[model samples]
Target: MKKQAYNPYLPSWEYIPDGEPYVFGDRIYVYGSHDRFRGNAYCLNDYVCWSAPVDDLGDWRYEGVIYPKVSDPLNKDGSMCLYAPDVTVGPDGRYYLYYVLDKVSIISVAVCEEPAGRYEFYGYVHYADGTRLGERKGDEPQFDPGVLTEGDTTYLYTGFCGVGDRSRSGPMVTVLGPDMLTIVEEPIFIAPSEPFSEGSSFIEHEFFEAPSIRKRGDTYYFIYSSIVMHELCYATSKSPTKGFVYGGVVSSNCDMHIHSYKPARKPMYYGSNNHGSIIEIKGQWYIFYHRHTDGTNFSRQGCAELIKFREDGSIIQPEMTSCGLNGGPLAGKGEYPAYLACNLFCKDEEIYTPLEVCGWTAGSLK
Candidate 1:
């Protein structure tokens, strides 16, 4: 038998010896989030960050609590618990993190000169005019922060729950200062009225959250959870701040692939896939997102899958259990099904060959 081309992908609990894997670099960092089961015991869930080299996911070196609820009385730090976080090596060589500041939905920024250090809170990433964007009075505000950069410009994309309803405020992007601690642009709505965003925990919690963005060639792709907690959908735009059109939904539910309606086993997956991020490793794009785990008590943990891009500029997220890159590298893989279809502008035209009929398979492009 021939050896497999790549290493097998492992989910969080299966990889890291303890806690849930949160971010990755030379090692995968696992962090603990406040799970709902812990009722009134003082919800101060400690976020202990641990790192394990990718070559050996089973062993981890505890990195300690990189960010703890601060002692400040004025900030949510008093009661807020940190949720999932996205870590990035800032252009300035510093480590920047954009993470949810608990149920209140505030997205805060912290920086560390090193990847695994005690991060210091650096105030909110305010709007371009120096005013904090998206902070509404009396509003619990939003959650989850995903940051991206194009050329010399940097944008901080965050989402929040809408008031008087469970639907989310949808994902929005704001420009960030070179320092990454301040906002430099007005918030721009990227996915308004997110299609298929019906009953997902994000929606049930009041809106679509858990947003991840990636840029391929000249186009930008934003992958987000749809209607239910198990569905993933994406939107694409040439400009990060405008004209983003919803593409479609991909299901991680074992029984089906992509669906527009609720199925019986859905909202199940209790290791329901949500919060995720995209990073290019060795020139290929891979998605790292969390899924539900079924221990004596169910919890959410992280997983990785390879992602492919269509020739027309959309992302092709395949279904199945695979490593972070989805199907692996596309350098010489055949052409992707996405490229076979015309640009979204051709959405109204029917002059096209059927998908399965053509050799354009539905996953990471060849």
Candidate 2:
């Protein structure tokens, strides 16, 4: 086997560094929901997109924002509170972005011909009876916008909350049109896990939101975030467009690693693991998620070791990725300097916060 060099990628935000990432072309595009804790920007989930090109499995070039807050089609008001985003390069050469807006709690999309561009808004999906799909009051379609393609057909899987009369686990599958703008089929119920109370609100959670999908050979696996918004769980089926069964939970149920039930410490506690994405490169699969370092508030960026299936055919749980991973350009790097922690410095600084230098122990720098 060729010992390929490692690319130990870590999480970052445009304004926060905990912004999530996805892959397109030879580069990884990272996007995050903006979080401003004070002033007028507090809790506003605005979004920013960026790209990091990986030439070898060693280093990456950080390209700046491709898209910023322009409009909110769902809210119809243009107030900028964008949430998690999923990017896919369509077979037709256009790039589609599906994201959520916080004020209206609905998922919407915009498309462009280039990987980085000013996207044009497309119409949204609605229920079969013609009621708008996400207009429900409390339970908005939630995290991890997982999309999968089989042949000419594309399917979307998102973690949703089943509010009121809806099924508690939420619908996991909805077919997207070839144009990547609207839904083609009615959304289907797939993952039948237990209900949870998610977010700071901690209301009754529909199951299996924050989903990521991957197809290895003939099997399609749907990895999801679970357990009242803390643990990572997964399900699988042979078909990319069909039956998905619960695959069990990853991470512990307690706050031994961090405190999850309190504010300011929530990200360090137990509330930090949801909204994850997975991608494979050079034969290894990587799980990217968030975690808390102190309390159960906002989550910080986190990743897991590449999961490998045992010879017996069972897959192993992903180990929590840290600054010590033996991959990418920053493998042997030391501590993250204090200056790198300031969100304001990220845009202007020419330095790299190498994966080797990130983690709770690195300490938050400003």
Candidate 3:
């Protein structure tokens, strides 16, 4: 009999969210922000990794801490927390990890010779004048970084805009040189923020944060978390940096917009901010996302669902399922944990889990 894979593919105790899955050679490695089991804040731990052979999605092995919070000079005392990150293999055949500190607006870079090895601090993404990307006079603050390198050029996608915040324009893309730390082209807004989405295709689902980029054939898929917070949405463009049209939701943590089993507006599970991207493993495409757990938004676990792309290059939103990554339905007989329940809800049918239920405030624990 074959081993069956379940949702929250990692061990139950692990809290790895904002997953960016990539297939480097024969293994698929997942890089994401590490969250504490029951922590007060988001991503309160160092960056760790987990990977598995391309042939087996069920056998995940811990890759240990690939990067530490204190490794960056700006976070010497480890006072700042590490946020969501993305990894790209550079032109030099080295792996580069891009991330931003919790309190800083600049994007930082770390490099390693191998995919899952310890990464050393490289530098901040800056300009020829030596000013960092976010430190420029009129530059927007850099947040979740999603990067893709083709040949010697890398497209860096980043931004964090809250609803009705005019200061933030939207998700922006910048071009980097071969070095991967210096900007070759200035930042340009690919989508509209909530405040500026009046007549745009992204009117209702304006870009919020967590911008990741992937290319399938000739189409560039830009995955992001919209202002809705619970769903991971996507945009498609022929070019890497411009003319992006809003696609539909890839997956929702609370199972919203799925009317096949229940009302479209009804949320079946506790939902919060969702982040992740799509990856193709062994010719199969899956969306890697996270879900709120431990009754709090801080502790998040990763989840993935099989996604299909239409001939026109559109993806239908996938429903949250307990038998994710299994490639098919589970066997008729087996033992499953209660946490694998994808349709979790109370009699009240609450869509979101409130922080008060977990005795957690914005920046402090009660």
Candidate 4:
């Protein structure tokens, strides 16, 4: 008998998406929105975590529930589900969580002293006019907040989708005050030009979703899902908020095998929003993204692959793999969690997929 490789990292029962990976205190922790297994609707559960020592990706352990949906103010209206989030170490040496309430599209912040621990709701981001964004723009949406705390200042990157349109203010970066709560400056747009945004396939759609910001050497890498929607594209700049040049692509949620994707008459994997960051764990670089499971977007599971960068700082697209964090196949003997199965097959020749939180599925594509 041969050993099988693992992809989702955790056991099959745990469904987590929008994975944001970070390294702290000799351990690499993954923070992502918890998805209900076999459930409907995107991000139907709270935020949970999984982590492993920096030396061993195969030793992943559940970090328990970090944040609950019921604690959110929107829970009063029964419409709150935590979305994708990013955490940064503040100047005061605390971890700050940045995310948006799913329905309201309002960016909220949470704070805790430790990663993957209980987080207390902090506050909502506001504008220079002193009006909270949630109150000012009821119709307009501003969600998917990514934060980078460098030196004494923290930069918050947010996306404001134009109503009924995909393109809007381009990549926005705002400076946050010391509390990591209030906006310190008017948001600046790090515009992606025609050459950089090979992603803007639809003129009507721009800066679609999922943002991650990191600084390598002196260059700032602003990673997000551009107009291409499914693929994770990136732009780089010396400055965090301006002069961004599109740096090809990172990877696609459905098509991780290659970069050049032509429009097809047929469909692909259950395409959901792709959210992850490029983090250097130990000395290796990896692209962390999620894949749809059980033939539904809502039941998505997190997956990652190792990546290499060119001398020019452009990333080579990585292929989807079953050996995701593990580096190799698991031993034939040992108890493994359900989430780690990569090659799922049917019990029989029949396939009968069910409705997920999104309410519809085609019964194909495992």
Identify the candidate with maximal TM-score: 3
Give me the runs in candidate 2 sitting further than 4 Å from their true place. Answer: 1-22, 37-45, 55-60, 74-80, 127-131, 135-144, 162-167, 193-208, 250-273, 293-296, 302-304, 324-366
Candidate 4 regions off by >4 Å? 1-5, 134-140, 160-167, 192-206, 256-270, 328-366
Q: Worst 10-residue stretch by lDDT in candidate 2?
A: 342-351
Which lDDT tens digits does candidate 4 get at residues 170-283? 557778878787777767767542233445442323466787898887988887875555567777889887777767678666553353442332223444567788888888
Residue-level error in angstroms, candidate 3, position 207: 0.5
What is the Cα-based lDDT of residue 334 in candidate 3? 57
N/CA/C clash count, model 3:
0
Per residue, candidate 3 scores C-alpha lDDT tens digits across 1-366 of 556787888989999999999999999999999999889999999999999888888889999999999999999999999999999999999999999999999999999999999999999999988999998899999999999999999999999999999999999999999999988999999999999998899978999999999999999999999998998999999999999999899999988999998899998777999999999998889999999887899999999999999989999888888778888876667567766767754545567877544333222100
- The 0-to-1 C-alpha lDDT of every candidate, in the order given, reads 0.50, 0.50, 0.91, 0.71
Query: Candidates 1 and 4: which is better by lDDT?
Result: 4
**Backbone clashes, candidate 2:** 28
Model 2 / residue 100 / CA error / Å: 1.8
**TM-score of every model?**
0.65, 0.69, 0.96, 0.81
**Clash count for each candidate, listed in order shown:** 27, 28, 0, 11
- What lDDT does model 2 reach? 0.50
Model 3 segments beyond 4 Å from truth? 356-366
The C-alpha RMSD of each candidate to the native structure, in angstroms, is: 11.6, 8.7, 4.2, 5.5
Give a tens-digit lDDT track for model 1, residues 47-164: 5565655544435466766876662223544566565566666777777767665544556677888877888876666655554444654323555666675444677777743334
Which residue pairs collide in model 3, if any?
none
